[model samples]
Every structure is written in C-alpha cells, then in structure tokens.
Target: MKELIPLRLSILGHPQRLAVFRLLMRRYPDQVPAGEISDALKVKSSTLSSYLSALLQANLVTKTREGTSLRYQVNMETTRETLDSLYLDCCRGRPDLCTSYQQPVAPKERHMTDRKYNVLFLCTGNSARSIFAEAILKSKGQDRFEVYSAGTQPQSSLNPIALEMLKAKGHDTSALRSKHMTEFIGEGAPDFDFVFTVCDQAANEECPTWEGQPISAHWGMPDPVKATGTHAEKSLAFHQAYGVLQHRLQGFAALPFDQLDRISLQNAVDEIAKTSD
Candidate 1:
C-alpha cells in the first residue's frame, strides 16, 4: 500500500499527465482514441506517450484495441481507491473530517447571464430537426449557451412526432413552438455566436444575414417529416434524427471553447457533423 500510493502520486505529479487523467476521467467507461486525446489536449505524440506510460504503470488507465485503433480508458475503480486512500491519510480516523468529497464547480457551471453564447438552429419548417436541436442544446448546455430554433418558412406548430420523441426522453415539450427565421431579423434580435442548419433544404437556401456574422455550419440530414412508411418506421426516423443531433451537440459541448479559436471551433463543428452521421 505504501509503495502503490507513492507510485500513483508520482504518476499524477506532472501537469500534462494530470490533464490526461482528468480527460480520461470525464470519458469514464467510454474509451477514447489516442489521436483524439492528443488533438484535444494539444500534446505532441512523444509527450503524450510518456504521460500515458506513467499512467499505465500506476494502473490509472486501461487500453483496448478497436479494429486497428488503440483506445484508452480510465480505470475508474483504481482512481476511486487511490482517492479513498489519500482521503484516509488526511482524515486520520476522524470520520467527520472526510464525510464527503465535493467536486470543485467548473467555470462553465456559472450563471448563463455571466457568459452565455447565443446559438441559432435553422431548418425548412422549424418543426422536427431544429426543434430537437433547440431542446437538446438547452437541456445539455446547462446555461453555457442560449439556444433558439427557426425556419425560413415557419410552421404553425411543432411536429407531433418530434414532440413525442423529446417527451419520451424526458424533455419538456409544452413551451416549444415553431417560428419564422425572420423573427431573428431586424432590431432587438439576438446577435448569435453560432448558427447551424440541420436540414439539406435549409442549408441550400439563402439565409438571413445576422448581426454578428455568427460561425455557421450545415449539419444537414433528411427531413423526418418526409419519412413515408409504417408508423413504427416513421417514428424511428424521428428518433434517429434526435440521436444524431444529440451526438453532435454532446461533441460540441465537450469542446474546450475557451481554448479554441474561431477557425478551430468551426472546423470542430464541421467535423462533428461529418462523424456523427
């Protein structure tokens, strides 16, 4: 136990190694490709290898092969054991002193008004894909970004299938409604920071000019409304659209926005659309 404690401490002592551990911790049960981790942390291949080697020696991480790629995953059980040991040393049998361990709140957990980035999702009818994007982002973004959805030709109401899918996923559907993209035009409209077109038709059409010239991308997908099949098959199409949007939005939320420049952020968003589909 004495030897293992020092070994784990040594592995975590380096800043770069600690950063990699934290990244792997965030991913937890899901393993990440080594290349992706390298890109995300901005560490060179040689440097990352050294860091990963230290972690592996201490049993702080695990690796598995997927097809041709090697994926690294956090050894969460070992991590928790190490933490428990450290806490025991500090508490020294005083149960009251180590009753709970609170994780430090992150900067992104701050109030939305403090540092809110506005996002707009555009589609042909603002019915299914756009509405799904809005709900998913609003729910997952956790006040880090303000999200709105609109269409070139607004529908009178939200699509039923879309509402059903969201509701099944425990998202509130009462207040969601369809609206025209024109609402974002003229004075008093939000100067968006990012804009995403989720339908091929909307992506091909000319969009209204925004005040801030937001970073825009087309995450184009087939319209769920046009799915012509059995009730089960049609509903499945909406579910799939929800899934693709969820994957893309999760990827976006995971980005280190504070560290990435506009060009990099644009590239990341584009890459997500390509890979998520």
Candidate 2:
C-alpha cells in the first residue's frame, strides 16, 4: 500500500483545527482577522494563536501583515492539493469514485433585485424542521426573501429540541412560534410569493390554493421527534436535520428570484425542494 501523506494526517488528527479550516474555507480567499476567528470559534486569542501557528507551519494558511495587524486566509492552492491527496488516500486505487467526488462549481451570480418575494412554509407539526427552515431563511435571506411558517395542526409550544439546536448554531429564535396557516389564509393574510408543504400529509391534503396562487412546492423531512432514543440521541437527530435545512435554505435564499419569471421562480423552488430529500 502507498504511504498516506502528512497533510491528511495533520488535518484529520485535529478536529478543532479542521473546524477552523472549514470556517476559513467558507469565507474562501477573504483575509480574516484574528478577532473574527476568535469570536466565531469562541476560542480565546491566546489559544487560537497557537492553533493558527500550527496551521501556518503546516502551510494550510497564509498570513499577511496589514499595519500592526496580521490577516490569515486559506492557502487555496495548498488546500486543494491537500484535499486531492485525502481523496486519493480514501479511494485507494479507485480513480472513478475519487474523480466523481469533485467539488461543485458555484452558480453564477444573477443580478435580480428589482422585486421582492414572500415565502411560507407549512407543516403538520410546525415544531421542528419547519420552524428551523423559517428561522434560517429569515435570518440568512435578510431583505431578499420574506419568509414565514405555519402548521396545519399547531403545537401548543415550540419544540424544545428544535429551539435548542437553533440556539446552539448561534441563531436567534426568540421571535419564532407555532402559528396556524389559517391566520395567513383569510382576509388579513399577506399574499405569498411561494407556499411550500414541508410534510407529506400537508402536501397531499386538499386545501384552497394560496390567495396569490403562489408557486407551491413540497419538501418532506423525517420527524426528528419520532426518533426513539435518549435525549442526546434525539438532539443529534434535530441537529442533523437542522444542518440539512440550513444548507438548502442558504442556497434557496441566494437565488435571484426577482429576475426570474413565474415559471423560472417555480423551477427554482422545485430545484431547492429536491435537496430536502
């Protein structure tokens, strides 16, 4: 067997270091100051400095002096090589799977800010994934997408597991609650740009088309509460679902909805719903 490379070992051995690397990767090619890293990771400057030094030594990150401050950014060339090496190591001699796992190219940015769109998420329980999808889109989408969530049969309280997962991810959930879809369906309900059914039952149920006849989509996710296990086990399920929703919603929010025609907008929603599965 061929020897595994040192860079792969360095990264895989230190989970915290890998997390820092991911953070930098997410903000790729952007020079971030030490304080930002410290804040994001909740690590003290003194502690983070040691990790940063190790990364610099490993050639995973590059540092530049900006006045008295030092900015650190991912060394993309080295990072790419490291990733390639890891892929080769994992696949051993299987070139097909290794080649098939190439990173996807980012979609081209479309300039479409002339109009605004409102989105509504509906589910049977409205307690876990639906609430999470709503909160994430509202926070991440900002002015790009107006978002809300409702339930067919509303729960008396928000799901504790869902709230905990959101707070753990540094998201504010104080303003989130379980609301009835009826509140938004009648005379007072604001017309939605899109209405999404996040549960199978809600998707199949016969209901009046939305007031605005908004584009409708279905995204079905397993109920985290149905998982039978300890509290920790249940929490893990919620966290996993939260991650999936967060990733998909981020992409959906980034779409140029204003520029797309109705058919195009519907297509965009359909594409995003596919990710939920």
Candidate 3:
C-alpha cells in the first residue's frame, strides 16, 4: 500500500501521460498505433516515448507489436484498481460521495456458439483478394460462418493464380466462381451479418446497401493481379495475398462472436487490418 500510492500518483501527475492514456481509453478498446496517438495529441516522438514508458512502468498502459507496427492501449484493470484504492481512502469518512461510486461491471465473456453467421467479401474484380478471403474464411471458419464473395464487376473467370494457390493448399476450388454483387442483393439472397471489402477500389465504389444493416469493414490489400515482372514474381504475389488472407481469416475465426456485442465485433474486424500485412 505504501509503495503503490506513489507509483499511481506519479503516473497521474504528468499532464502528457494522462492525455495519452485518456485518448486511448476514449478512442478504442482494441489498440491504436503510436503515430496516430502522437498525431492526435500533438506530442513529439521523443517526448511521447518517455510518457508511454512512464505509463507502462506504472502498469497503466500496455504496448504490443502487430506485425511491424506498435500498438498501445490502456491497462484497464490496473487503472481501475488504482482508482478504486484512492476512492476507498477518500470515502472512509464521507458517505454522500461514496453512495454514487459503483463498482464497474465486468465485460461479458466471448465464446462461439452453434449459430452460424453469414459473411460477404467484396472486391473490384472478385479475382484475387476477395476470392482468397472467401475461400480461406470458408475453410477456416469450420462451418461457423456462411462465407461468400462477389465483385462490383464480375470477372469472366476466376484468376488462375488464385485458384492454383488455393488448390496447392488443399482448399476445394469447385464451388468458387466469380459472381456479381447484385446477385446477393436481390430476392431470396442470404441476409449477411458481416460484409468486408478486401480491396481499396471496391471499398470506395458505390454499392447496394445491405438489408440487415450488417457490420461492415474495409480490409484493404494490394491487388495481386497487377503484379508485373517474371512468372515467379507474379506467382509470389498471389502466394503472399493468400498468406495474408489466411492469417486475417484465422484471426477472424478465432473471435468469440457469441460473446461480443455488435460494436465490439465491428471493432475486432477493423483491428484485423492493423495486424495483417
């Protein structure tokens, strides 16, 4: 108790550190990049490092590596504990202020249930990125999601490179084909629970509004179709796209959808972009 007070006080005493902590708490529960944090707070990199280090030492914040990017988030448990300790001390002799202090409710547990979610992956040509995402998620989701892919402009045929890559990895390429996005929007189509745009072009293009107000996110990636140079280079680009989609889809499948509410699920989907290549 003697040692804890000063540790907590030292973290809260500095204005810059407090600002960074508060900013993280307000923006996202997942995590935000250091560059975004610094930009928003108008703090220099050297100075931000010192502030982040202080918070980290006090256990008020945590830093994690997502690929090559560094993400920071508030350590809510420690912050709550420190605040609770202070309130306890001040409320010992006072009753009125104590009356309104309620213990924070814990977040609900996230777990997968039997209910299957419908998801759509969209892209411009439905050739590489979206097709790969759909195939990967369908296999990895383990029948937990009804996965589909479509495009604004349907290709005459699926990209040969994407097909070969999936087949090499033991993914079934039988049912996969390029289809227009309008097919899903018309009558008798499965209402989607989640929709993700896997390329910048489709994400920006105007499209039919979904029926169920499904949670949507942009998981933009470089188009492998435009890869130029030697045959090996083009093949490698497709391989990399496949790998990136595999990583992203695996993370998506691991999410505890039954436990998280709509907003949390949306946030989780968006955070995947930061963690992926």
Candidate 4:
C-alpha cells in the first residue's frame, strides 16, 4: 500500500527497532526466534518485545510460533509494498536520482588511510570463509587494518580444512577460534570501520550495531564445510572461497578511502564482492 512507506519507515525509526529490522532483513525468507534476535542485537528481552510488536503492528515483519518461543521474519509481500511505493515515488518525483548509481573512483587507483582501520567479518559459523577473510586482511593489510571475525551461531571449533589452508599460506592460526559475534559488542569493543558478512546462510547471521555506524555488506558464499564431496573437493571449495575473499579484501585495501566520500566508499566496499569472483 502507498501508506506503508511512512509507516514502515516510522516503525524502523527507533534505533533498536531499526537494528532488529536489519537483522531480520539479513535473514529474509526465514524466521528467527525472538531469543535469537535479542542475542544478535544485544537488546534486552523487554526492549526486543516492544521492537517486535512495533514491527508486527506496522506489518513490516511477520512472526510464528516456534515451540515455546516466537520466530519472526520479514514480510516479503509487505516489503514489496514499500519497495513499489519507493520505486514509483522516485520515478514520479526525482526521476533523475532513480538512474543507475555510478561509482566515482577509478578502478585501479590506490588510496591511503591516515590510521589503521578496524574491520570485522561475520558468518554463521566462524570456521571457514570468515576466518580466512580475517586472516587474509591481517596478513596483507598489516599496517593498514585491524581485523577480526565471528559467527552468529558459532561452531564449537574451527574447520580443519580452513586451518590447513591458512597454515599452508603461513598465516598464524594460533589466535583463531570460532567465537560468538556478541563478544565484540559491549564493554571495550573496538569501533569498526567496515563489516562484511561472508556466509551464504545470512539469515542465521547477526548484524550488530557498531559504536560508530560502520559500512557493511553481504559478501556471501557457500560454506565449504557443507560441501558433500570428497575431502579434496571440500578443500577446493575452501580454496575457491579464499580466493574470492582475498581478491575482495585486496580491492578494499586498495581503495583511496581518504579521498572518497562516505557514499562512494560504501559503494566501493559493496562493489568488491560483485567485481571479485
């Protein structure tokens, strides 16, 4: 409905609710338990209850019972109502702004940051892809970036194949362990400059709010652990994923961040996954 835009935006205007909406959006087409949402957003049960109620009342998200708990999901059908409204509004009002968004920088140009950037990679399990990304950036951008990785529903251990890959590449894996995403929030968490979700199962992943709003993107890929082939095939999957993430990270590292504005920098960060395998 045409009325949904304001209602939806208004409902999402609350910071906690907006975070909840984004967490749900990342997990679109699937339902997440209210408990899970609370854990992911670091919200108290009471605050999350109100956020969910507002989202549900605005029809921005829908929920169903999951045993004793409630599971919520993005109302895709309702989502489209807002999308259609925005599309038509842009077409009718600011048609020039509706055109394809173009990146403002030259592809190969390298830029420098005056200070080290804090970056985080997230995945459902901090085993393979995200671990590799953290390792890769820490290794390559040693002076330029501080890197970390975590999972939404963390696995109890790291993936063996991933460990082998990093070892062969001579990266120190001693500091690596599968960790919960919440460990980075609250207390003395480092403020992040960029956050990327490197898992295909994004719905199971949580997008937390950083102290400062960090640039984020879904650099999603299939989990090598879930690969159903021989050991070699699984390793190859891990290798392929590493290459893609490595390339994307290199591209990110090369961007002249000090020169680009926030919008351009975000576009650059988001373009990496698309441009790299």
- What TM-scores do the predictions have? 0.59, 0.57, 0.61, 0.64
- Please write out the lDDT profile of model 1 over residues 171-249, one tens digit for every residue: 9888789999988888999878888888755654546667755766778777889999898999999988998999999
How would you encode candidate 4's per-residue C-alpha lDDT over 1-277 as one tens digit per residue?
A: 6666798878877887888888777654446788878876678999899989999988989989967989997886787677666666645635476432222332223345557778999988898888999999998889888999998888999999999989999999999999988989988998887878887455444455666667667677778888878998988888888989888888888887778866688667756757547
The worst-scoring run of ten residues by lDDT in candidate 2 lies at 103-112
- Per-residue accuracy of model 3 over 98-188 as CA lDDT, tens digit each: 5333412111222447668889999989988899988888888866989999999879999998898889889899999999999898689
Clashes of each: 0, 0, 0, 2
Which pairs of residues collide in candidate 3? none
User: Runs in model 1 with CA error above 4 Å?
Assistant: 1-114
- Those runs of model 3 whose alpha carbons end farther than 4 Å from true positions after fitting are 1-112
For candidate 3, what is the lDDT?
0.78
RMSD of each: 14.2, 16.6, 9.9, 8.9
C-alpha lDDT of residue 207 in model 4: 55
- Put down candidate 2 lDDT per residue, 1-277, tens digits, no spaces: 1232585456547977776776665444356678878777888999889888888877888999899888887886776677676676656746577633452221122335654567898887788878988989888877777789988888989998888878987888988999888888888787786777776555535446676456666766677868878998998888777877887777778876546655566557666766742
